[model samples]
Target: MSGERVGAAVTWGLLGAWVVHDLEELATVPGRLRRNVPQLRKRFPQVPERVWRRAETLGAAEFATAVGVMGAIVGTASAAGRLTGGRSGLYQSALTGFGLHGVMHMAQAAAVRGYTPGSVTSPLVVLPFTLWARGRLRKAGVLRPPRPRDAVAGTAAAAAATVASHVVARRLLGAARRTS
Candidate 1:
């Protein structure tokens, strides 16, 4: 495939992986956490059970919205890169961010010695897709091979976005609860 086509495929593949990963998390994460993470409630004693449940209920929506935002950013950056001779910093950042996210999921699974929320598909889907996308981006001259620092920074940015999404979700859920 041409560079632009490769980039577009990477973008779409990342989004698809995210949707599947989030669906896996939504289906199982809260229940798994309740069962496995012994210190969860103890660590956040201030959060009531009802609130926790509400957050859990909203998890999928929050994840979907965040992924959508990430997609828009990547798509816009990719388009710009195509228009401007393939200098897409945001696209590179996203590739690094998502690639590292796959690694994080694998690490989480390894630490627990079992399946964690997104673990089932992280290696099988996310990692491979992200790796291929990174390679395509490099071959296309849209980005260089990811560096350690770039990955770190990208992951940090992604983490911040995740936190922001959670905050927004919480507020929305809280409002809905109040109205009900």
Candidate 2:
């Protein structure tokens, strides 16, 4: 790899990758849920009424606000990654969460047996880019081995962050539907 490419494999690249993946979601999520949830509710009447209500009611405005909140977090993590040469806990934690997020997207798609927001890029851009970045970090001798507890913490952190962002967005937008 070129020297410059090697240098950029992790830091700002993390945020860049996230932006690309999230852009797909920003464009598709609200519409996908709106279009699909009704059919899902019809086909699977066992689904809880509240679950259908949330999915059906999610608006683009609230979803975009949540994305913006997450963008800020990822931006801060990227800055820390740059300053620390990818050694920052904040950056690495975000990276771990991001990679796992892609896996969850794939699983989500599989569960539904159809496309969902983020499904298209999860294998194409998200998973591959995350693998490439981890490989680059390992080659540079900076990739810390992840502990099992780290996985748990990362997943919990990701879920918490998602809920917090949506909650913040819901309050900020004053939307009738709770994005969270």
Candidate 3:
């Protein structure tokens, strides 16, 4: 394969692996919150048990929705990247993924029926593993941090895994893409 093709393959491959890991980690976040709920309550005396319980129940739905929304947006961005014939699609798709996620999370929290345990503390609760995963990936020498000129490395990493999964789906059939 040509150098460009190799780059694309590696980029896609790395991104695919990252997406799998990200989804797995995302799946674990609510459970982690459940484990931390008592400590969180102890730390913030004003937070009620009812609030945490509600968040736990709602977390699955919220997370699923967020992932679905982000998946659609990022998929479009990735296709745009491919159609435009530029590698920059990877970066753009990544940015849209995390950016939309952040916005959705904030909106969910501010909107009615937003009472997830980690809603208010998502940054603190989520960032540690997020950081740790990035750090470990960097340590393992698979992915690198975004450059100063490219401020979207972390975001790209976040979307890489999801996009990778889509790529896999796109290979399956048109029907899968539509449903996905």
Candidate 4:
């Protein structure tokens, strides 16, 4: 495949992986947290259980939207980089961010010492897919090997996505509630 094709495949694969990850989280994260991580309530006493439940229930769509938006940004950057013969900084950042996200899933499972949401697929799906995508990008000369700075940028992007997901989920949930 050409570079663009490879990049596009990788981009879409990332989205697919994200959807699966979000679905996994939606299925189990909140209930697990409520059952196992009792300290979560104590840490955020202002947030009600219903609110958390609602968020968890809506997490798949919220995360999908967030990942889609982020993917668009990275995809655009990749296209622009190819056209202009420039470095794909945003694409690299995304790769780093997503790779780290997979690692975070593993870490969360480790901390809990059990199966955490997304844990089942993190190693099998997210990590491998991310690594493969990064390899493709590098081979295509779309991006260099990721640097520590890229990882930091990616982490920041992930943080921003979290906030965006919450905002989007709230709006979606609110609209649904109003309609009902």
Q: What is the C-alpha lDDT of each candidate?
A: 0.67, 0.85, 0.47, 0.66
Model 3 ranges with Cα > 4 A deviation: 1-15, 40-57, 89-149, 152-180
Kindly indicate the candidate among 2 and 4 with the higher lDDT: 2
All-Cα superposition RMSD per candidate? 4.9, 4.2, 11.5, 5.1
TM-score preference between candidates 2 and 4, better one: 2
Query: Each prediction's TM-score against the native?
Result: 0.73, 0.86, 0.40, 0.69
Q: Is candidate 1 or candidate 4 better by TM-score?
A: 1
Candidate 4 residue spans exceeding 4 A from truth: 1-7, 39-88
Return the TM-score for candidate 4, rounded to 2 decimals.
Answer: 0.69
Ranking by TM-score: 2, 1, 4, 3
Per residue, candidate 3 scores C-alpha lDDT tens digits across 47-154 of 777877754554544555555555555455445444433345453445434444444455655643544433443344233333443343344344334565444554
Residue 46 error for model 1, in Å? Answer: 18
Give candidate 1's whole-model lDDT: 0.67
* Cα lDDT tens digits for candidate 1, 100-177: 887898897786676778887788887887778777766766666657888788999778767776666666667878
lDDT of 2 by residue, 19-69 (tens): 999999999999888989878898779989998998888999999999999
Best by lDDT: 2
Model 2 TM-score, 2 decimals:
0.86
Clash count list over all predictions: 0, 0, 2, 0
